[model samples]
Target chain A: MVPIYYYLILSAILFSIGVGAFLIKRNIISVFMSIELMLNAVNLTFVAFAHHWHQVSGQIFVFFVMVVAAAEAAVGLAIIIAIFRTRATLDVDRIDLMKL
Target chain B: MHLVLFFIFGGLCVAGALNLLFQRHPINAALSLIVVMSSLAVLYLLLGAEFLAAAQVIVYSGAIMVLFTFVIMLLNAGREDRTHGSKAAYLVGIPGAAALFATLVYIFLSYRTPLGDAGLGNYLVTTTDLSKVLFRDLLLPFEVTSVLILVAVLGAVVLARKEH
Candidate 1:
C-alpha cells in the first residue's frame, strides 16, 4: 500500500492549484469551479485521515461536504445567472456594481 | 497496483486542474473540472472509501458539473478577457503558489516517518459500515443537510426566475 502521506501530498498540490486558479481566473464560473477544486482537495484529506484512523466519520464528513457543494452550486449558479442578466458580463472585474 | 493506479489518476487530476486554471473559455474549464472530480472519485475508491467514490462521481462530476455546464450555456459566458491582473499574477501568483506547495510538501514529508506508516489497517471501509455511522451517530447533521438542500432549492428557484 502507498503511504498515507502520498495522498496528503497529492491533495496539497491540488489545493495549491485550486488556490492559484481562484486567484488568477476572472470568469465567475471558473472561480466557482476553483472553489470546488479546493473543496475536493479538502475532502481528499478528510478521507485519507479517516482511513489512517480507521474511523468512518471522515467519510461521513465527506458525504456532508458533497451535499453542501451541491447546494452551493445551485445557489451560486443562480446568482451567476442573475449577475449576467444585470451586468451583461461574466467577468469578475465588471460585476462591481457597488464601485460607483 | 494501487500505487500505479494512484499515479495515473493523480497525474490526470493535476493536469486537468492545471488546464482548468489556464483555459480561456469557461466551458473548457468546466469540462476540466469534471475530469478532476472524476479522477478524485477513483482515488477515493483506492483509499477504501468506495461509497464516497461512487457519490463523488454521481453527485460531483455528474450532477454539480452539469449544473455548471447548464449555466455556462444559458448565460453564453465568454472567454475570460486578459486584464492587468494576469501580468501581476504571472509575476507573483505563480511563485507564491509554488512556494506554498513546496512548504506543504516538505512539512508532510518530514513528519510522515515520525508519525509512522500504515495507520490504515488492512480493512477497507465499506458502504454498510459507513451508512450505519451516518444514520446512527451523525443523524442531526444529516437531517440538517436535507433542510439545507430544501432551502437551496427554494433559493435557486427564487433567484433564477425572470423578473417582470
Candidate 2:
C-alpha cells in the first residue's frame, strides 16, 4: 500500500506545471489544455483523499467534474472557433480588439 | 509492488503533462494530454476507483481530447508565434508554481496523523457505489449538469455557425 501523500504530491506537481503553462503559453488552445490539466490534477487529489478516507462522495464529485469539463470543452472550443473566424489568428496576444 | 506501479503511472502522468506544456503544436499538445489522462486513469485504477478510471478514460481522454483536436483542426491554428507575456509571468510564474508545489508536498508529508491503515482495495469504489451515491446524494448536481450541457450545445451551435 502506497502512502496517500505520494498521489497528493504527484497531483500538486501536475497542477504546478499546468499553472506554469497556463501563464507562459501564448496560444489559447494550449492555455485551455492547461486548464484541463489543472482540473485533472485536482481530480487526482480528490480520488486520493477519497481512498484515504474511505468515502464515495469524492469519486462522485470527480464524475461531476468530468461532466462539467466535457460541457466546458464543447463551449470553449466553439468560442475558439468563433474567435478564430473573426480574428483569423489563434495567438492570445493578437486578439486584443476587446482591450480597453 | 504498489510503489513500482505508482512510479510507473505517476511518471507517465508527469511526463505527459510536461510534454503538453512545452509542445509547440496544439495537436501535439493534445496527444500528450491524452497520454496524461490515460496515465491518470491508471492511477485511479490503482487507487481502487474503477468507475472513475473508466470515466477518466472515456470522458476525458476520449471525448474531450477528440473535441479539442477537432477544434484545432477546424481553427487551422498554426504553430504559436512566441509572444512576450507580462513581465510577471516571466519573472514570477515558475517560482510561484514551484513554491506552490513544494508547499503542498510539505503539508501532505507533515500530516503525522495516522491515516488508520487504509489500504487500496477494489471495493473502495465500484460502479454500484458510485451510482448509488450519485443518484442518492448527488442527484441534483447530475440533473444540473444535464442542463448545463444542453446550454453548452446550444451556445456552441449559435457561436460557431456562420453569421449572416
Candidate 3:
C-alpha cells in the first residue's frame, strides 16, 4: 500500500517547483501557471488528509478551494490580458510602472 | 489495485506539472494544467471524496483551465526564445527551492503521528449527507463562495473590456 507520506512528499516537491518557477520565470503566463501548480499542490494535500482522517470536511474544504481557484484564474488572466495590451510584452522585467 | 491506481494518477500529475514548468508555450502549459487537474480528480476519488472528485473535474478541468486557455488564445501570445534570467535569480531560486523541499520532506518524515486505524468503514458520507451538511451547517460559506465567484466574474469582465 502506498503510504500517505508519499503523497505529502510529492505535494511538497511540486509546491517547491511551482515556487521556483514563479520566482525565476520572466513570462507572465509562466508565472501564472506556477501559481496554478501551487494551488494544485495544496489540493493534493487536502485530499490526502481527507482520506487519512476519514472525514468529509477536508473534501468539502477542497471544494471551496476549487471555487476560489476558479475565480482567481478568471480575474488574474483578465488582468494579465489588460497588462499585455498596454505593454505589448509579457516579460516581467519590462513591467516597471509600479517601480518607484 | 488501489496502489496501482494511485501510482498511475500520481505519475500523471507529476508529468503534467513538469511539462507545465518546461513548456515555453503558454497554451501548452495550460493544457498540461488540465491534465494535472484531471489526475487530481482521480486522486480525490481514490480518497473516497466522490463529490469533491466530481467538483474538481467540473470546476478545474472544465471551467478554470478553459478560462486560462481562452485567455492565452485571445492574447495570441507566441512562444519566445527562452528568456534568460540573471545569474543571481537562478542562484538564489535554485538553492531556495531545494532548501524548502528538503525541509518539508524532513518534517513530514519526522512527524510520528499514528494513522487512525478505524478506516473509512461505515462512516463514509454519501452525497446526500454532504448536501445536508452543506446546506444545514455550512450554508454561510457556500453562499459566500457564490458571492466571491460573482465578484470575480464582474471584475474579469471589467478588466477585459477595451477602454474607449
Candidate 4:
C-alpha cells in the first residue's frame, strides 16, 4: 500500500508542471495541450480522493469533468482553427491584436 | 507491489509531462501529452478507478490527442520560435510554479496522517456500482451533459465552418 500523500504529491507536481508549461509555451496548440495536462492533474486528484474516502461520487465527478473536457477540446480546437485562419499563425505572441 | 507500480507509472507520468514542456514542436508536444495521458490512465487503474482508466485512454489519449495532431498537421505548424516569447515567463513563471508545488506538497504532507494509506484489493469500485449511482441518483446531470455535448458539437461545426 502506498501512502496517499504520494499520490497527492505527484498530482501537485504534475499541476505545477502544467502551469509552467502553460505560461512558457508560445504555440497555441502547445498551450492548449498544457491546459489538458492541468485538467488531467486535477482529475488525478479527484480520483485519489475518491479512492481515499471510498466515494463513488468522486469518480462520477471525474466522469463529468471528462465530458466537459471533451466538449472543451472540440470547441477550443475549433477556436484555434479560426484563429489560425484569421492570423495565419499559431504563436500566442504574434496572435495578439488587442495587447496594446 | 502496489507501491512499485505507483512509483513506476507516477514517474512515467511526470517524465511525459516534462517532455511535453520541453518539446520544441507542437507535434512532439502533442505526442508527449499522449504519453502523459496514457500513464495517467494507468494511475487511475492503480487507484482502483477501472472505468475511468478506460475512459482516460479512449477519451484523452485516443480522441483528444488525435484531434490535436490532426490540427497540427492540417495547419502545418512548425517548431516554435523562441525569440518572440516574453522573458518574464522564465523569470517569474518557473519560480512561481515551483513555489506553488512546494506549498501544495507541504500542505498535503502535513495532513498525511489523516489521509492514510490505500491498499489495493481491499475494496475495488466496480463499474456496476458506479452506474447505479450515476444513473439512479445523478440522472439529471447525466442528461444535462448530453445536452452539453450536443451544444459542443454544434459549436464546433459552426466555428470551424469556412467563412464565406
Candidate 5:
C-alpha cells in the first residue's frame, strides 16, 4: 500500500498550481478552471485523510463539497456569460468596472 | 500496483490542470477540466471512497463541466485577446505557489504520528445507516445545501435570461 503522504504531497502540488493559475491568469475562463482545480485538490486531501483515518466522514464531506461546487459553477458561468454579453470580452483586466 | 495506478491518475490530473491553464480556447479548457475531474474521481475510488468517487463524477464531470461547456458555447468566449499585466505577476505568483507547495510538503513529510490501525472492515454503511446519519445528524446542512442549490439555479436563470 502506498503511503498517505504521497497523496498529501500530490494534493498540495495541485492546490498550489491551482492557486497560482487563479491569481496569475488574466482570462476569466482560465480563472474558473483554476477554481475547479482548487476544488479537486481539496477533494484529494479529503479522500486521503478519509483513507488514513479509516473513516467515512471525510468522504461524506467531499460529497457535499462537490454538490456546492457544481451549483457554484453553474451560477458562476451564467454570471460570467451575462457580463460577457455586456462587455464583449472575458478578460479579467478589462472587467474592472465593478472594482471600486 | 497501487503506486503505479496512483502515479498514472496523478499524472492525468496534473496534465489536465496544466492544459486547462495554458489552453487558450474555452472549449479545450473545459474538456481538460472534465479530464481532471474524472481522474480525481478515480483517485477517490482508489482511496476506498466509493460514494465520493461517484459524486465526483456525477456532480463535477456530468453536471458542472457540462454547465461550463454550455456557458462557453452560449457566450462564444473562445477568442480572448491577452490582457496586459505586470511581468512581476508571474514571477511573484510562481514563487508564492512554490513556497506554499514546499510548506505543505514539509508538513506532510514531517508528520510522524502513527495512524491508528482501526479499519472499517465490513462496516460499510448500508442505505439505512446512510439515511440515519444523513437525516438525523446532517439534516440541517442538507436542507441548507438544497436551498443553496435552488438559489443558485434561480440566479443562473436570471443571469442568462435576455434583457427585455
Candidate 6:
C-alpha cells in the first residue's frame, strides 16, 4: 500500500513541471503538450481521490475531462495550424501581433 | 507490491516529464509526452481505476498524441531556437511553479493523517460499474460531450480549411 500523499505529491510535481514547461517553452505544440501534461496530473489526482472515497463519480468526471480534452485538442491544433499558416513560425514569442 | 509498482511507474512519469522539458525538438518532446501518458495509464491502473487506465491509454496516448505527432510532422516543426524570451517569464514563471509545487506538497503532507493509504484489492472500479454510473447518473454530460465533439469537428474543419 502506498500513502495517498505519495500520489498527490507526484501529481503536484508533474503539474509544476507542466506549468514550468508551459511558461518556458517557445514551441506552440510543446506548450500544448505541457497543457495536456497538466490535465493528466489532475486526472491522476481525481482517480486517487475516487479510490480513497470509493466513488464512481470521480471516475465519471475523469471521463468527461478526457472528452473535453479531446475536443480541445482538435480545435486547438486546428487553430495552431491556422496560426502557422499566417505566421510561418511555431515560436510563441514571435506570435505577438496583439502586443502594443 | 503496489508500492513498488507505484514508485517505478511514478519515477517513469517524472522522468518523462523532465525529458519533455529538456528536449529541444517538438517531435522529441511529443515522444516524451507519450512516455508520460503511458506511464500515467499504469499509475491509473495502480489506483484501481481499470477503465480509466484503459481510457488513458487509448484516448490520450493512442489518439490525442497521434494527432499531435501528425500536426508536428505536417507542419515540419523543427528544433526550437533557444533564444531567451522576456525577462519576466524566467524571473516569474520558474519560481512561481516551484512555489506552487512546494505549497501543494506542504499542504498534502500536513494533512497526511486524513488521507490514509491506498492499496490494491480495496476498491477496484470495474468497467461495468463505471458504465452504470456514467450511463445512468451522468447521461446528460455524456450526451453533451458528444455534441461537443461534433462541434469541435466542425470547428476544426472550418478553421483548418484551405482559404482562397
lDDT of 2 by residue, B25-102 (tens): 999999999999999998999889999999899999999999999888878877887667645675787888888888
Instruction: Spell out the clash pairs found in candidate 4.
Output: none
Per-residue CA lDDT of candidate 5, range B1-164, in tens?
Answer: 77788889999988988887677787887898899889998887777766667778888899888888877787777655554562566788888988999999988888735532213232343445546667898999999999999999999999988898
- What residue pairs clash in candidate 3, if any at all? none
Per-residue lDDT over A1-100 for candidate 3, one digit per residue giving the tens place of the 0 to 100 score: 4567777887897898888878777678878888988988988888778777767787778778888888898999999998988888887777779633
As for candidate 2, its clashing pairs are none
Docking class of 1: medium
Please, what is the TM-score per model?
A: 0.95, 0.95, 0.91, 0.97, 0.91, 0.97
DockQ per model, Cα: 0.72, 0.73, 0.61, 0.86, 0.60, 0.84
Query: lDDT of each structure?
Result: 0.89, 0.87, 0.80, 0.92, 0.79, 0.93
B24-135 per-residue lDDT for model 6 (tens digits): 7999999999999999999999888999999999999999999999999999999888666835676877999999999999999998899999988788999999999888
lDDT of 3 at A14: 82
**Clash count list over all predictions:** 0, 0, 0, 0, 0, 0
Candidate 6's residue-wise lDDT over A1-100, tens digit each? 8999999999999999999999888899999999999999999999989988999988998999999999999999999999999889999889989633
**What are the iRMS values of all candidates?**
1.8, 1.6, 2.4, 0.9, 2.7, 0.9
Candidate 6, number of clashes: 0
**Cα lDDT, model 4, residue B31:** 91
Determine the backbone clash count of candidate 5: 0
Native contacts recovered by model 4: 0.86
Per-residue lDDT over B60-148 for candidate 3, one digit per residue giving the tens place of the 0 to 100 score: 88988787888778888788455456355678877898899999999888763563321323235478867887899999999999999
Per-residue CA lDDT of model 4 for B1-164, tens digit only, reads 99999988999999999998889899999998998899999888888999999999999999999999999999999998875464877787799899999999999999999999988865578899899999999999999999999999999999999999
Candidate 1 on A9-81: residue-level lDDT in tens? 9999999999898888889899999999999999999998888887888889899999999999999999999
How far off is residue B128 in model 2, in Å? 0.9
Residue A23 shift from truth in candidate 1, angstroms: 0.6
Score candidate 5 by DockQ: 0.60
Kindly report which residue stretches of model 1 are placed more than 4 angstroms away from their true locations once superposed: B115-121
Ranking of all predicted structures according to lDDT, beginning with the best and ending with the worst = 6, 4, 1, 2, 3, 5
Worst 10 residues of 3 chain B by lDDT: B115-124
**Candidate 6 chain A: worst 10 consecutive residues by lDDT?**
A91-100
